[model samples]
Target: RLPIKWMSPESINFRRFTTASDVWMFAVCMWEILSYGKQPFFWLENKDVIGVLERGDRLPKPDLCPPILYTLMTRCWDYDPSERPKFKDL
Candidate 1:
């Protein structure tokens, strides 16, 4: 899920994982299940994940996924954590 503990420890210490991150993880998990345990970002390196995350980008979801679900998944990866939906809404 969201790595709340994986934040940077700077002087300002604005390090905190949010619900958005959790949603991202959930989407990743869904992808894994849909692919039957196939690797995610297998073709991409770890840095790619970081880059996409930093840029508020998400993995290209499967076309079979319903549009509603896909939209929710993308919302989970929102750059602004506050813009993310809550668990209840998810």
Candidate 2:
């Protein structure tokens, strides 16, 4: 469904797609993969996700996600797209 749960903050606010946004979506994908396809932000609707993210809320690490992997995931979800790590750095 390409839900809001997979969107980066910049992607949400500015409607711009970039490598950083791709990183953010990929991190969500990683979370989904590690969680065995569990939905990201299962409780939130599309409209709510933007405000939640603007408030600095992010997906919690899945129980199956390794701590080190979760750390990298959070870096990919950085509020500022420019601050996100490059794919090469991952």
Most TM-score-accurate candidate: 2
Q: Mind giving the per-residue lDDT tens digits that candidate 2 earns over 1-90? A: 556789898777788899999999999999999989889988998889999998988899899788999999999999988899999998
Which parts of model 1 have CA positions greater than 4 angstroms off? 1-15
Q: What is the lDDT of residue 50 in candidate 1?
A: 60
Model 1 poorest ten-residue lDDT run: 4-13
Residue 5 deviation, candidate 2, in Å?
A: 1.6
> 51 in model 2: Cα distance from truth in Å?
0.8
Deviation in Å, model 2, residue 62 alpha carbon: 0.7
**TM-score of every candidate relative to the true structure:** 0.68, 0.93
Q: What is the C-alpha RMSD of each candidate to the true structure, in Å?
A: 5.2, 1.2
In terms of TM-score, how similar is model 1 to the real structure?
Answer: 0.68
